[model samples]
Target: MVRRFGNGTATARAREEALGKLPSPRGRLPVIGHLHLLGSFPHVSLRDLAAQHGRDGLMLLRLGAVPTLVVSSPAAAQAVLRTHDHVFASRPHSPVTDILFYGSTDVAFCPYGHHWRQVKKIATTHLLTARKVRSYRHAREHEVRLVVAKLRRDAVGGDAVNMSDLLNAFANDVICHAVSGKSFRKQGHNKLFRELVEANSSLIGGFNLEDHFPALVKLDIIKRMVCAKARRVHKMWDDLLDSLIDHHASKPASERGGEDCDFIDVLLSVQQEYNLTKDHIKAQLTIMFEAGTDTSFIVLEYAMVRLMQSPHLMAKLQAEVRNTVPKEKDTVTEDDLTGLAYLKAVIKETLRLHMPAPLLVPHLSMAGCDVNGYTIPSETRVIVNSWALARDPSGWESAEEFVPERFLEGGSAAAVDYRGNDFLYLPFGAGRRICPGINFAIVTVEIMLANLMYHFDWKLPPRSGAGRWH
Candidate 1:
């Protein structure tokens, strides 16, 4: 049932005619397109390319025979994310996401449609609502206590902890507690959860030839690794959800029917109402666990790195947090987070600098559409470069510098915000496809950062150059 279009056919002709209306590319390389110049740091390379090509630069990347379009400016991003959102809302099918996300049942990777909408609604209403996120304050506090306790012990001996691992563990614990009402550190635990978390993170960050070349998807060596990991993760998720469902079902109706319901309780209610199967519930839980844990960890890691590199910024942040939060408090409360303006600015800056998913997950055009005078054929894959847009000089001042002040009052940079309105600052993405966990993520990150700053003073390990802390 797969249909192929010929260059000389009417479909191609119509596309060419549509292309005539859009902004033309300033330049393009041969068969490889801009691949050679892109190298590993595609974000920076694309930024430079856009500077030379102009705001509406369009380039054809020969990602195999398919000419994938990479849009690098705010205007172009708006065209893709805002003006033509519906036309390009469907996700590009990938072997990793397809298998890991239960054939794209999750909110982040699901193609735009009824199924995606249903999944997103459940996430927003039951899992990521502000009330739901705030209800897990004890979990967040407990995990932060563990993180700080461990860090303090390590710092006592002047030990250099691989912050990456610590942060990953912190995020994983918080997410697990939030989603399952349990922590990975619980006694009598299985190692499957940790294994699946590691594998999922690796798959996201690891290079996969299959993403760019669909024809070679089955032939690629990474496919085997992906399948193995997927099977393991699927099994673990199935077991975990089965237990949660059973536990809730066993609970008296009085306990389960209360207003204080967890994610599992919410899903069960939905299942009964919609007459959904256990498999559907499992698919939803799997997506939430994998996506929630990995993304929050990535952002936290990036924030820590940026703070380490900018000591003055760190000192200022710490001072602000200490001044705002009392030492007697065992944990920083959600209300405390609101008063810490600088902390919010720091997080916003980190996200602006390093959006975890730089490409914002590719979307396929369901139907032919015209954007900025270019004709996009129906079924053509489109990628929105949120990473590039965040740093576009046109949108931000000194875009490369680590200046959190840009988000403060009266700063040169305007408050574009991240609530799906500004395409330039879409770290959570935009339109109907925006991430559903945005509220939960913000609360978790803000609370953690505030507590860390309030509780301790951080410094680079001895013998390491001061340059490490900048």
Candidate 2:
């Protein structure tokens, strides 16, 4: 019979006794709890511990001074991502996300509540809507032209190109143009933007021990890196936003109020509606750029890498693109995306294999909650390892393999959607906090990947062994 715990019941006592009897951590070093066990890859270490402890088991680790619970199974993921999504929706406060997100003013890292909702709604309806995203088609085409030009140069020179860097530049240009009506190549290009983008991406991969353990935040070396990066990024971000605000202020009322509304315009409108301060507006812009830019770039990079590693998949994807998209077109139109199911599958497959925010930003339990029979205490920092869940053998057939066809007909694979409902495959996360830019991201990746494949046949550069680049 199943057991229940509450109110000092026998089941509660038994559960406590069992927990007490569990072996003490092997050892703990001063100021760094179980850091040795984490080695270099903390995620791998957590997975090993979870496997030993059984699915849904909790392994307490002191990330610095913070207590963290790493949940590694699909069932546990469901518990955290679904059953108690509200409790886990709020992001943990950390120096890295705090500074980078303009003190958590942005939607991605903001704590769940009225403030987050306000920002999220504006982002969804005004900035990231399908129609708004489509308006940026010119930006996509312009960036792709630059990418093709570079690739052509590489092809003619027989030089090995770092496909990752190429894609990064492409993503940067597209995002810059979409948000600011400019390109990375625009006047006043500097290293600050690059550093800021790199720092944000690295931070997502879990570099700051302070994030997991707040007590030791001041002593964290990673926090120092974050602080330095934040200073540079915040300056660039402020300048950009201030320029937009000033531009709007100087423009004629009709030009400012009508179809000329850009991301900055939407933010200004929201600022007026909510009576937000200038700092708040600046903070929101910082969030949009930080969250939207690198994540899309990383996804695109991983998609290309996976496609390169899997030739059959690449060929199949190319055939689908060629069949659906006309050759004379410079780029695949958004309308063309609907007919490219295989292309969608490839993107989904890449997301499955490489979730940009693998853990989906740690969610804190605002209040006590019951999940899969476990009475999770209030204030427990809940983590959902979407990476493990996506790769779980039980949830997916040949989960680790790069097989886009598994998503096609007659396949035994489970349904994997970016929409927030499916806990097992939430690349953009699940619940009300789901990323608003999912549609934009999907279309951008699809169009970019389609154009690349349609225009050129990719090959490992000559004299550079497989996977090597100049």
Candidate 3:
């Protein structure tokens, strides 16, 4: 990042000078630039750095060879994510994603362009539409039932159930049902999906030298070392997806289009319509599987962890769920989820406090744009510190506390929401790249949590304590 060439032209030098105006935290070192300013957790590091040196919610950092613009407050977020969304809506190229997602063809990682437009249209209009999400109600309910059954069998007589494993399995099974089909468990494919998702998450989430030092990957040794695991995981995914797609494709075309179709089936039926190659179809499904399984599981696990640490919140949520749900039903159905104010409040609070992706996916500026009186150069990568924005002391009352009631009627933040309308609480993000699976993810969480709360009273295991979980 410290490499400096002779000032070649007015435009190049001018752009460099403009970037200098953006505030940067102290302690930058040679070659690494601001990379050393970041600690073990980049989001926390950015939040602390932004507080000390940020100007007008904007801070600039040179992450190795790349120069990034960090937006750390609600106003700046609105300026970038809303006002100049088109200018900063595209994703930067990543070598890892390129291999895993078939040259970055998936909706989440694809750069902003015509292909992105087409796939996003297919997803929003047909694949992940509200009606389409509703169509998976039975499958979701069945998965919840299976979860309840497993908990009943495993947690008998003061045994401590591993909610982490249980919830992870539930989330995976739910996604499997949605993606592959009902009979996926006959040969333990759900377990395989879980393993692949974990491998992918760890590989992508961990530190990668190529991300910061792009030039190093050009060497044969560095390229092989960096891309070997990605290649393995991609093939694993490809083989599994190919088998499932072939199964769906083998069936007569006459029987394929309906509410019973899995995600793969839906993608195939519209392959010609969307001009999708088999790679394209597999790419979309891979991204969808990873997103669907990982996101819901993390949120659910964190919600349970937080609630266990707070007895009042737990009781409040349980009371609302048990009282509102009909006693005759064996499990809480999606229909029973309506009007459960506290349940929804708990979910909203969970999302606000523990956004799965603390940093919104990195966005690359397509053109120069002025934000909050500062000029951002074209091709500048932007990251919104969502964790900072949601928990800002200036914006939220009791910003550090886990208070779900704040989302209730007449509460301090009753008007705030996650749909990007309110910049302060953007768990699902805003604008064109906002998560298309919001409906799918939210309903999945609601049904499983509601059923878990209704069917059993949660507590710490007998070996650990005789008291309440807290």
Candidate 4:
């Protein structure tokens, strides 16, 4: 057999790859760029943009001062996030991140490089390892029981329990325990954390005006408005984190104070090893608490919402959770999750339909790269719409429906996973910068959902009670 390298096909392919311009929407404003196209729900708006303009799966839009690339399909997501991950490994800088995350020193916003890699390594290996996460089994179980107990107490008088607030509190308390070895609720700091989480979500959710129009923010009016909000948030974050760190620091070396010697203790012990300063520790703790509590609870809340929407699916999950745990068992253990395959499938389905960060954290291109024969230049803010990708018709059957069975053993979409392997199903994202909290998040969400389903039967509020169930 002879292999010829002199064919015109090779040269033609190279030429095509080299000369391609990124597909962009038609109406791009001069200074504001595509900022006008983005509305309150940018994910939906951008998804529409990709559908109309991104015939090749990648759409280039100028977002204010930044050139942004939106990856709306699985194949394109894989190309950008997996194939040429290193080029798109870094995170794009935004005023929102800088102000909220203490100059983006935290893991999520930290620029991709040596410092990021070091912090990531420390977190994955020491803080969030499978063994470390599993070690907190008691803490998770304890919190879940508290959730069940509270629901029971509410049910005693036939009273409606607000799962939203209670679940938020449950997640907050669990994360507080894991982070600092004590419950923030008991300490009366849960309200502050709650406010911070709400603020972070609001600021992070939509397109911030200051982020898009950086130059416009230089005006006294815009600057003061933005700075005022940022300062208030920063002060709250600073005071709470300072108190948490101080509490841990005041502990005697041998005492090692904390519930199960929390993440705070772990980070403090290795502070010298990582050359970490107080700000660094605070940033890390802030991220851990903020991300762990807010995102996990949101997922749980949505899971419950979805379950209540369909009684059939709810019954299926309840049966799995109930059968997996013995009738006499008061709490569902982590080991029991292995046999409860359908419960896991329900969680997957929920995430597929309602992703936490619909548009994942944007990636920055460290250098120019070619995606699907199009050249994405350096410093382009790359966004993978995990929400759109999850619901893409080609990849998922009954794309808009809530079908948990699709992720079950014999189902067609069973092979897809959330652990960054299958690009089409990346609820957590992919590549070198994939979320490091996978183990922690999965465990927290699964346990919480399992207990909620197992212990109590949920009911829709009477006012909105219609034919929601199937």
Query: Best candidate per TM-score, number?
Result: 3
- Candidate 1 minimal-lDDT segment of 10 residues: 461-470
**Candidate 4 C-alpha lDDT tens digits along 1-470:** 11112237775454334324677888878888788898767788888889999967888888886677889988899998888998889997767777777878888989998878878987898889888898888988988888888888889998777888988988887887888775465788867787787777777764577766678677988877876776688788989888888887898977663436788788888889998888887778888877888778888988888888788889988988887799999988888888889988988888898878888898988766667877666666888999888888988899988899998989988888888999888888899888888888888999989988888888677775533221
What order do you get sorting by TM-score, best first? 3, 4, 2, 1
Q: Show model 4 residue runs off by greater than 4 Å.
A: 1-20, 183-186, 217-222, 257-259, 463-470
Give the lowest summed-lDDT range of ten residues in model 2: 461-470
Q: Model 1 residue 219 lDDT?
A: 62
Q: Candidate 2 at 165: error in angstroms? A: 1.7
Using lDDT as the measure, what is the rank order of every candidate, best first? 3, 4, 1, 2
- Error in Å for residue 96 of model 3: 0.6
Count of backbone clashes, every candidate in sequence: 7, 1, 0, 1
The most accurate candidate by lDDT is 3
Model 3 lDDT, full chain set: 0.87
RMSD of each: 4.1, 4.5, 3.5, 5.4
> Residue 241 CA error for candidate 2 (Å)?
3.3
- TM-score of candidate 4 against the unseen true structure: 0.91
lDDT values for all models: 0.71, 0.70, 0.87, 0.81
lDDT of 1 by residue, 1-470 (tens): 12234555787777655544444344445543445566566666655655665335565455544556778767777887788887778887777777766776777778888888787787777778887777877778788888888878888887678877887777777776765565234632324565676777677556565665567656647567546666666667667667777876777867755444667777877886655577767677766766677677777877777787678999999999888888788778777887898899888888888777777777788777666666677767777778888877777889878898988888765466878788788888887778888877777788878877887766665664533210
